[model samples]
Target: MGSTLVQRRLSSALAIMTFAVLLTGCGTWWHGDHQSVTIFTTPPDAAVVVDERVHLLAPGTVSLNRKGNHHAVATKDGYESAVMTLSRTWSWWLLGDVFGCLIVFSPFCIMHDIDEGGYYTFDDTIYITLDRKSAAWAPVK
Candidate 1:
């Protein structure tokens, strides 16, 4: 009876843990390599554009891929446009998925990995100070 009771408890614990793992997303269960980055500027409220398409205001956050150009442009009415590029590096946590997916519950773990919402691991902050555009001008010849 003692041996049988121990087996039941052990099996119960395993079942609960397995359920939790299955419920967890790949990115949540295993950290990703990139993350969302928040950008802010000195002047504030400037037009922030990325890759010539994504547009937002200063003091905004953007989710960027781990691998891609992070160039952004910030422009305001009387200020010179600020062009900046962010740095992105490989994250060691990306290896976590390898271990998580290796388990028997990999099928459910892979489900979250396939979703875009669960993936974003960038680690960079962007801050820009726009310079006032020079008022002086010369006549074009």
Candidate 2:
């Protein structure tokens, strides 16, 4: 009877651990709210501005928040600046959150991901081309 009691306790503990793991939002637990995005531009050393704040030079990688839409502007001397918007969209990770949390009957898990912005994601890479200004209007040396 003593060994049987210990075995039952072990099984209960294992079950509880499994339940807790499932209750953790799959999206938040896996992807979180920050994503690394790579940028490339026609002019190799063009200045890249993200959201008019963070600055980088392509080709490079920047970590961006996944909560909302973001924009990038790439510019080089004598070239027209190029702008691109990185929009956040629902991802497969959100589906993982829905199914995994549903298995544990925990709506809070899904809601937690929604509130944390883990259900959305941005593209992994961005590429832009800057057109050179007209010869007639080119900057004087």
Candidate 3:
């Protein structure tokens, strides 16, 4: 009958539309030759370690695309050294936190009062001076 043919055609059209939508919603697949790594430090002047090797750059973020297990270590004099593990998802989180903190603190840093002319009298004052060098890291040798 003509009605049967119409019903089959409609069902076919619906199935094709559903398939198209599923394919489009899947998004693009990640196919790349490298992995991403992100590093962050508290003081922003600490040394960075990559895979147990010391990178001679200042305490900041460095990205690597090499695959495999990557280790990171941050160190500065007079402060404790920090070790971090890296993965695809975790690296993204670290980058987000680092950038977020920087954005949030930028205004505060720019508007800080650096004048030391004001003096305050306190009943008890304690001051401690520490002599420490810059940060450094090296592979186990």
Find the candidate with the highest TM-score and give its number.
2
By summed lDDT, the worst window of 10 consecutive residues in model 1 runs over 113-122
Quantify all predictions' global Cα lDDT against the true fold.
0.69, 0.84, 0.42
The model with the greater lDDT, 1 or 2, is 2
Question: Using alpha carbons, what is the TM-score of model 1?
Answer: 0.55
Q: In model 1, how large is the Cα lDDT of residue 4? A: 100
What would the per-residue lDDT of candidate 2 be over residues 1-141, giving only the tens digit for each residue? Answer: 999999999999788768666646777778878899999999789999999898988999999887788999999999999989888889787776666665567788778888887888887988889999887876879
Error of 1 at 15 (Å): 16
TM-score of 3: 0.37
**TM-scores for candidates 1 onward, in order:** 0.55, 0.77, 0.37
Between candidates 2 and 3, the one scoring higher on lDDT is 2
- Ten contiguous residues with the weakest lDDT in model 2: 96-105
Model 2 misplacement above 4 A: 1-23, 137-141
Candidate 2, residue 128: CA error in Å?
1.3
Give me the runs in candidate 3 sitting further than 4 Å from their true place.
1-31, 54-59, 89-141
